[model samples]
Target: MSTPLLSLRGLLKRFGETVALDRLDLDVPSGEFLALLGGSGSGKSTLLRMVAGFEAPDAGQVLFDGRDLAGVPPHARPLNMMFQSYALFPHLTVSGNVAYGLRREGVPRAERDRRVAGALAMVGLEGFDRRLPHRLSGGQRQRVALARALVKRPRLLLLDEPLGALDAGLRERTGFELRALQRETGAAFIMVTHDQGEALALADRVAVLEQGRLVQLGPPRAVYERPATRFVASFLGGANVLEGQPDGAGGLDCPTLGGTLRPAGPLPPATTACALRPERIALRPGASGTNTAAGIIEEVAFRGDDSLLLVRMPGGAVLRVGHAEEDGAPPPRGSTVQLAWEAAAVVPLLG
Candidate 1:
């Protein structure tokens, strides 16, 4: 295989009592869009900061094109990091702001103008060059920030919560625009985000973090559809964990779980606990099966397209099920209901 454009080898970082990153290793392919996804304390932002040179790793190496980036200052690296705050100059006009980096780099004024204008056009803010940061809408200001970052034409772009400040609608739109821009420029873009939906929508692959460690890394669909462990399933949501007896072949035989559930992934031999996501579970409702469980509806939450049903099983485990139909209106809350699913849908997890 060709060498990754960027690689992190055994990278480690710590901030006083907290271990921000723990021997993290990752490789970014050329022109790929990667999302560093995690909760508030998961260390996604910290990792991004380190990658951007704002913070240095305590150990390990950061590689660009197989060359070490050790000791290189932020500006010397072939990268640009767009801060979460945009960090736009309040006093500079849109064009002036976008041209800031170019001017600093000592590019000729005409060439700087051309590159800045091109970058602005790419972000759909070509005509807003005369407007100051205060005069621009939130989205427009963000586009200008993007233009400034892009004008430099770095081989790699790091985004720390790029859409965190925008409104919901604008955030959605900007996600698409960013993806399109990545493809057009063929630059490797790594984004840090706490929003699962944003990661799902934009990333070619996602790296989910926990306490500074990468729990899983894969395409968005693979990470969501086939998580690596109990931690990943639970973090990504929709998983209904069940304690079971391993049946040797990635299958779990649980008396109350009502089926012979096979591991959708490689289940370690000692695993006694398993999880089946709500969406993967196909109910054989009211049908008799080994995988069928007797449950009482505890709560039913109505979402427009799907409903969340909490079912208390005979074994005392509460199973969260998601479905478009409420299973006969969620069995009238507290009524006994039968829940069944396929063996393949069971995603086995650690004990």
Candidate 2:
């Protein structure tokens, strides 16, 4: 395989008694969009800072195209970062802000102007150059920040919560624009975000971190459907993890469901648990078959596009089931219902 565009090997960082990053390693191929996903204090931001040359790693290496960046300063590194705040100069116009980096590097006036215009056009901010930061909408400011980063033409771009400042509606729209821009540029991107939907939708591969450890790294579907650990399953998709023991007859003796469930796929050795996504479950009033269970509807939550039904099984374990709005109104609360799913929907998970 060709060498990756960026690599982090045995990277470690600490803040007094707290371990910010614990010997984490990752790689990003050329032109690939990788999302560093985790909650606060999961070391995602610290890792991004390390790559940007703001925070030096306590141990290991940050390699870019086979070059070690140990002593490189942030500006000297062959990369640019877009901050969550957009960080545009309030006093400067959009054109000025986008050209700031090029001017600092002493690029010729003509070349800088051409590059700035091209970058702005790439981000769909063609005629907004003279507008100051405060005059533009939130999304426009985000694009201006992106234009500034792209103007540098860095081999790798680091985005620190690029859409965090936008409202939910604007965030969704800007997310689509961000993905399109990345594809058009073909530049490697490493984005730090805690939003699971954003990570799954935008990233080619997601690197999940927990308490400074790299827990999972793979394509979004792989990580969501075949999570390597219970934490990953719960974190990525909020899957219902059911603890069980293997029955002698190729089935899982799950106490949570009050029965044995035979998985369509062979269980890995020592597998003692499984994950089932709420959306994979089919709920009805009188469904009965293999992998079927009777339950009482404890609650129903309508979420516009879909509804969530909480069902209490015979064993008193409440399982969430997703009901699409197109399926018509869901059974009312306190109604007796049946929850059924395919054997293949039961994903074996490791603890």
Candidate 3:
């Protein structure tokens, strides 16, 4: 394999008693769209800033294109960052903002104009380059910020919650546009986001970070289907975590449910968590199903296309279920209901 486009070696940072990054290491292949995924305060943003030269690492070395980043200023590095808050200049027009970086670099007028036009076009804002920041919509302003970053043609693009400000409908549209734009440019994009769905949809690989470390890194499907840790499983998507013991039968012995459930993964005797995705648990009770629990309906929220039912299982386990074919079948609050899940649907977490 060739050398990675960017590499971090023993990256360490600190603030008072807090260790922002603890001997962290990461590598980004050329043209790879990798997402640094985690909840708030997971240190993903700190690592990204260190790579962008905004924060100095206390111990580790940062390398871009095999060159050491020691003493290389942010302006000198082949990198650009787009913050969650577009940070557009209210006084500058779209074209003026996009041309700011090129102007500082002393690029000739003709070349700057050509690059600016191309960048704006790439982000679908070609004809609107003359609009002020206030005149443009939330999505358009974000595109302008992206155009400004692309005008410099940096090798690495660091996006921190790039679509955070947009509404839900606009966010979905921008996600597709951004993915296509990245593919067209082939820039190694490393996005730091708390939205697990965004990362799964956009990134070729996702690094799930915890307190201050990478808990798991893999393809979206792999990470979702087989999370290395219990935290990863529950964080990426909602899961019903059941505390149970392994029975001699290839299933879990749930004393609360008084039944055995299909094993999600090979579980140890000391396993404390059983991860079963909401979708995997069926609403219609199965006769031969290995696991079944009696619960009372606690809450029923009817979303547009589906219904979200919160069932309070025996022993106080609140299991969330999504039903697709509910025709106003309201299980009255406190009414008893049977919850059944396939024996093979449960994955055990023993760590």
**Which pairs clash in model 3?**
262-343, 262-344, 264-346, 264-347
Q: Candidate 1, residues 170-252: lDDT per residue as tens digits?
A: 99999999999999999999999878889998999999898888889999999887777777888786587677787776667
Q: Estimate TM-scores for all models.
A: 0.93, 0.96, 0.93
Task: Give residue 122's error in model 1 in angstroms.
Answer: 0.5
lDDT, each prediction: 0.84, 0.90, 0.83
Candidate 2: residue 187 lDDT (0-100):
93
Clashes of each: 6, 0, 4
Off by over 4 Å in 2: none
Candidate closest to the true structure, highest lDDT: 2
With a 3 Å backbone cut-off (N, CA, C), the pairs that clash in candidate 1 are 250-263, 258-290, 258-291, 258-292, 259-290, 259-291
Q: Model 3, poorest ten-residue lDDT window?
A: 281-290
Q: Which portions of model 1 miss their true places by more than 4 Å?
A: 247-250, 253-268, 325-330
Ranking by TM-score: 2, 1, 3
- Report the error of model 2 at residue 301, Å: 0.6
Report the lDDT of model 1 for residue 138.
81
Which pairs, if any, clash in model 2?
none
Comparing 2 with 3 on TM-score, the higher-scoring candidate is 2
